[model samples]
Target: MSLNRRVFLGTTAAASAAMAAPMVMADGHGKPRVVVIGGGAGGATAARYIAKDSKGEIDVTLIEPTRTYYTCFFSNLYLGGFKDMNDLGHSYGGLAASGVNVVHDWAVGVDRDAKTVSLAGGGSLGYDKLILSPGIDFVDGSVAGWDITSQNAMPHAYKAGSQTELLKAQLKAMPEGGTFAMVAPPNPYRCPPGPYERVSMVAHYLKNNNPTAKIIVADPKPKFSKMALFQEGWGDHYDGMIDWIGEEFGGGSVSVDPGAMTLTIDGEETAVDVCNVIPAMKAGHIAEIAGVTDGNWAPVNAVDMSSKADADIYVLGDASQQGDMPKSGFSANSQAKVCANAVRGALTGSKVFPAKFSNTCWSLIDTNDGVKVGATYEATDEKIAKVDGFISQTGETAEVRKATYEESEGWYAGITSDMFGAKT
Candidate 1:
């Protein structure tokens, strides 16, 4: 199904009275309250959609710690110097104007039995329905010799804000022939193609500026998303500059010394000027606190994204293990729409259509050189099963690559608008 603003609005209107299920009233409360945690693609989009479509019938509140949200998508472009920091930043004012009560604060805890979310600021918010989209948090001790305290020395720019700026600064300060190293995360991490794209972008910067700088990637996984295409681009654009050590070469056995600025792979130590360590990830702590996560991620029903542990609670984005869909911003945004529809229907007796989802991930290798992989999905009793998919080929024409890059730029604009509204 094609998902767009017009289609969404039209479908919601037409389906409003089609459901025979009883409306879940707010139990003497004036309005059915929806509390959404995390204000990235998933939470923000879900809040905006619920508020926009509910038309004052439901109350929507979005909780986010940062007033200026930086998108993880396209952040590698910022490292490649294709975009500035401001380019990735967005304000929550637009979401507020769209009728979402945008709360700027951290969500400290969830009281599942009480149906309340406690804030770090010493208050709690009750909700008829709760949506958790807190993104990913690094798993402790996933990478030896590195932890949150060592972040300054070995920056994990995966969160895409201060860390991104820090990494860029370190890259710029590197000496002419200095070494830059990355310890790539294992599979089932956010943005499957993200780490490789970062390697490409970092190499892009080094090739233009440092010229003789080297990049070493120690990957636990044997292969990565768009591996063939990334390898071809590395040969064409950054030959001899990137050394990727996969598991076959003992890349999985890796450690780093932030204090000494040293990287060890397979018992071979190498002094590196900068190290980027992306550790294993899990659903944000709130998901675990809410008692919805079986392991690292929260498992949800494919049809409505409701947590398996609680019918009134939903999970979205990287935090959700809904099956088939990769943890990406595009996937989260798509899931948010499906979820908003279901939540609205459950709360106000609105029509809820069958859930359909789609996601496309775009990566840039060099200047105006882009590639993508995407799939369509349908909800099944078991999971969100993939239906059809497409990917950019290894040897595409320059025109095609350039067009792909332009298409990504457009998508960035469109998705940001979709999540944050008309940029107030």
Candidate 2:
């Protein structure tokens, strides 16, 4: 359903628990220790919730490599020039101030038996419970003839920091009336509406700066999240400027040559000024290293997001295949709260609430033109199934679209605050 101000306020209040210092456990050993292996939406929120709700009964340590976190959610707007680099960047100092022992380092390994996490810099942290939210890593050979080494030429701006800057620069440098091609990923990737939103942002930039430039999308999936809404927006705002070739129309047979800057869809090769290869992805490296992944993603109990393989560990964000979630930042944040509640209860005998989830994904088609699709979920035996949903329909008036855009702006502010604690 639509994410209104009331919902935003409620979500914010849930995460706004007052910070407290670490307290000793009943057995006099120490506080129940919880180590989080990633510092994005999932990991950070989990750490915050356990620390705050447990009232310092849980000692939380968040391990993230980056000092300054750049959000993947609003990154597309930066490429569209609606926002700048600083606008998308956040500091972990706020989380640190919230009593999370924020450790800046890579998590190299996980010893399930020992209940320890090895850091890239050496040494390990002991944990009674662990949260893994390492985000997505590209699947090797998912996109034909593309690998990590060739990323400079055909950048995947999925990570939202350096790659985003690279893609934006490449997009602006395209020749007048030149072609910009994107190789969209298959299903179950992070942010289902992400690739299309990127296309919209890129078009927003090109339409203003280089109106004659064309955009082409070669996708492996026949349909995508918010397909009808996105298609309708494309037709209304940029009818002739965008072309999408889904799998039924030769997208599955697509290949790319990074060196030559050429994309082949069904044996027809076209040279493009820029290529963004959004390859198929899986849970980050640490999930598999921890031996928690079933195959590609870490399977979790939908009730609490605990790893089905190991109860001591939990998986959140894009890394967990809990069912029916689109793997958006909002979804990860929602899951983190449920996870935090369960973790706190297990550690401190705190009150546990029934698990419920909600996610809203907002996309900007052009200036002040936005649409969204979202749902509320319930935990069932099979999966976390959708209870009810809503979407921004076509043929809406300009005022409604602008209001939708404003709602998204409010969400971005609310979620980031919910996620990182605060700016200062």
Candidate 1 has an lDDT of 0.91
lDDT by residue (257-345, candidate 2, tens digit) is 99989999999999999999999999999999999998899999999999999999999989999889889999999999999999999
Model 2 quality (TM-score): 0.94
Pick out the ten consecutive residues of candidate 1 with the lowest summed lDDT. Answer: 14-23
How big is the positional error of residue 72 in model 2, measured in Å on the Cα after superposition? 0.7
Clashes of each: 0, 0
Candidate 2: list runs displaced more than 4 Å: 1-28
lDDT of 1 at 53: 87
Q: State TM-scores per candidate.
A: 0.94, 0.94
Error of 2 at 321 (Å): 0.6
Which number leads on lDDT?
1
